[model samples]
Target: MPLNPEIEACFEEMRDIRRHLHTCPEIGLETAGTAAFVKEQLDGFGIDHQDIGANSVLAIVEGRGPGKTIAFRADMDGLEITEETGLPYQSRTEGRMHACGHDGHTATMLTFARYLADHRDFDGTALLLFQSGEEGFGGAVKIIEDGLFEKYKIDLMFGLHNWPGHAENHIIVHPGAAMASEDRFDVTIRGKSGHASSPHLCVEPFAAVADFIGGAQSIITRMVSAHDKAVISITQVHGGSAYNIIPDEVVIRGNVRTTDSGVQDLIEESLGRLADGLASIYGVQTSFAYHRKHPVLTNSTPEPAMKAAARVVGEENVRTKELPAMGSEDFAFYMQHTKGCFVWVGNGMDSPVLHNSKFDFNDHGILVGASYFAELLKEVTRQP
Candidate 1:
């Protein structure tokens, strides 16, 4: 379907909003300025809204008639990366950038909010959720704990993320397990510290760190079934300060990503066991801390939502089948409480991949995303 003229006309305005957000990217739950800007826009539209958590905003737009109440979400967080896209309106905040296209997500939701406010043709209420800390600070959990679902009755919910490496403006709506669950771990191994020349006197931890790193990989390659998908990555290793000294302690931090909760549990248990065995063998003390970040984002029942998306982007542009991604999203938290589907809106195959220093949200997706949300509101909330 072609873009609605009204929505198409707002493209430049949305682009401007996106650029402005890109210039002043905020990280995690400290999205005060971004929330303020979003609130200002919502207030201009005369929509009813309120602040949820420290840096999240929620707006309600009641339709002309009564029907099911639906919710749509947009994440409002930036990565810790420095701006390298070199766009005229690149990040003004040093060491912070919207390399994940969150700027576009927020702008698209704002545009959809405007549409919902101006034309209340649907039957029920539409809740607009502007969330923060989706990059990994557990903002979604904070909002839920703040009584987001308890205060408001939402029958259905929906969310979108910009996907690179796909055709521009295309939509991918898989039915289940759209993304993986993220669990992070930190391991500290303590040993006797001594000079490098006194090898016999010192029980150095460098060997234990090396063995743990190598053995951690073996958990995925050997313990995990080849049919199942699991990834254990040791991204950071810290130890010795001076070349002449053997450090007393070594700290290793990494994360595990899996589609199944069972696999997640297995990896965590195996990791702890391996660390303990290594510590016993090396006569060193070891402490391991495992933290589950985000659950797997699954669209368990996506047919209705997929059809709604098809109405806006046409069936040809909607991809119903695709492999699940290893990345994780906190939108899974929302889905856990309510029935909803998370989808991907193509950011263009040639565009820079997300989280890359050069990555930027494609302006071309703003209108399409807004139009999809608008159409989805109409489809899901129509009088039955």
Candidate 2:
């Protein structure tokens, strides 16, 4: 691999960008300040591009030789977690933090942007997508709807997530789903409310709610095929207002995830039936409401293209952890339009899990990720 010395020097500058953005975290697509920061860097490189749907920054570097247009993606949104890293440049905006490492993702891509602007190695084009609202609100989908392909005409896309714990310089890839589809539901069980002394005369929604939670847990364990994976968790359950009085209603909120749309549909069906069954058994009224979040994030593996890209980084750095993650990513929206793989680079086992109140993006993974993006660009351009 031909690593540019100037590109290597930009790592420190990339680190500076990461820390600056980390101090002032933004929430969603309305990242005016963050967008401006990225725009300034793109301007410095003299690379021309357009902003789609508010905060997503797209820059194109036309390669020197010959090839097709391939795009590189990075997320820029932060989470609603308070900072605890205690770094001198800790989050200035209290209760908002770069918990998902988008700070690093954004800066790393900026590093690659620097690399490409300096080297300009191949032909065709390189698209640097700095996306926002990826933590929620389907940012990738919003960009596509806003005419990403119509404007740039991307052929193959590549994205990497700063993963937690494996090793530095480690890269991963494969085929099929790399991440699961996430859906959420809320239920309200209703029953007649009466005095504690009149137990026989009144129906309790709490009883039905408890029965439903228990019954819902069984749906994944019993109704779902043992081989087929699924997750059903009741995150919240609230009912009685007093120890003795039977509450009029109980509310339960939960989330479900699966590797395919079929499994997600099954989860919805089973929950509805289970709610009906609980209502029937308890002689109470029950209601279920569901919201589908995002679809499966898959990659084309065997994937000589992606694997060759990984090899450019190094064989040891290439990982085989192709198992689907229950956590959902909006990048799934991008994969729907182009054949690509979303790989996770280790974030560190010791690091706080994403979205945690104390979580902060680790700075050490900067070059590891920048190098991966730079290498992937070179590899993809080399192929048809």
Candidate 3:
């Protein structure tokens, strides 16, 4: 089916909603304003909804009869970037912007909810999830721990992200491993503090930090298979405070991304072993803390979901074999409990990359996304 006229007509309103969200982007689990905005809209539609976690919102739409229950999730958190888009509705909050198109995601989901509420042509229930802290705060985990799945029986769940490189309105879905797993580590190296004049008196952890940082890459290049995809990046490093005195300790922090769990385990083990070996050689005490944040987002059963997308965007516009991205998503948490698929909608190649200061969600993709969700709902909830 082509884009619904009702949804096409609502594009302007959805764009306005997206712009309003972009103006006041919130970060992490502190999305009180965003949640309130979503709740107000849901209330306007007279749809039953409730608050999950501290700032996430969940809304339900019941159909005429009993069937399978499905879910659509949209992340509501913004990045730490300051807006450089310079649009009339630019972000008012400094150092916070919806550079990842989450504003667009929320707007699309809201539009879908409005449509579903107005027309009850299907069976079962439709759950709309406005998740927060998808950036790194584990909002999905918090909501699940709060008994989200236990409260509602969802058979299948689907989520989408706006992609910058593909053509506008194009859809990409993968059967397995749509996105990589994310794991963070903090390594602290401790050594004796001494005066700058006394070179031999201090153990000097700076050397150990340098050695470990340089050697950690070997985990991916040598240890991991070349056929498999994995990445280890040292994003942060903190060491000496004063120029004259050698600090007692230095800390290194970074993240690892992989498509396989075994590779993830190998990376963590290699990191700890590298840190330990470096500390011993440099005569420093080392502490390595590995935090497994989000697992790999794999689509165990993607045929039905992919077919629904193809029906909406036409088979030519639907891509089923796109290369998986190295970026991570917390939606992996949902896939652990229920069979789900995470797809990517094109945000246009002209648009800036995600997390960039100037990036804004393409308003043109709103109708395409909302219509796709609506179509998927019809397909999944069809009476058997």
- By TM-score, the best candidate is 3
For candidate 2, what is the lDDT? 0.80
TM-score of 1: 0.94
TM-score of each predicted structure versus truth: 0.94, 0.92, 0.94
Predictions in order: lDDT: 0.90, 0.80, 0.90
For model 3, the run of ten residues with the poorest summed lDDT: 375-384
Query: Local error of candidate 3 at 301, Å?
Result: 2.5
Residue 178, candidate 1: how far off, in angstroms?
Answer: 1.1
Residue range 1-384, candidate 3, lDDT tens digits? 778789998888888999999999999999999999999999998898999976999998888888888889999999998888899999998999999999999999999988988987788888999999999899999899989999988899999999999888689988899999999999999999999888599988888888898889878889999988899999999878787999998899999999988899999999999999987799999999999988999988788777787887888999888888999999999999999888999999888899999888988778888988888887777656
Error of 1 at 1 (Å): 3.0
User: lDDT tens digits, residues 153-245, model 1?
Assistant: 889899999999987668899888899999999999999999999977988798889899999999999999898889999999988899899
The per-residue C-alpha lDDT of model 1 at residue 317 equals 90
Best-to-worst order by TM-score is 3, 1, 2
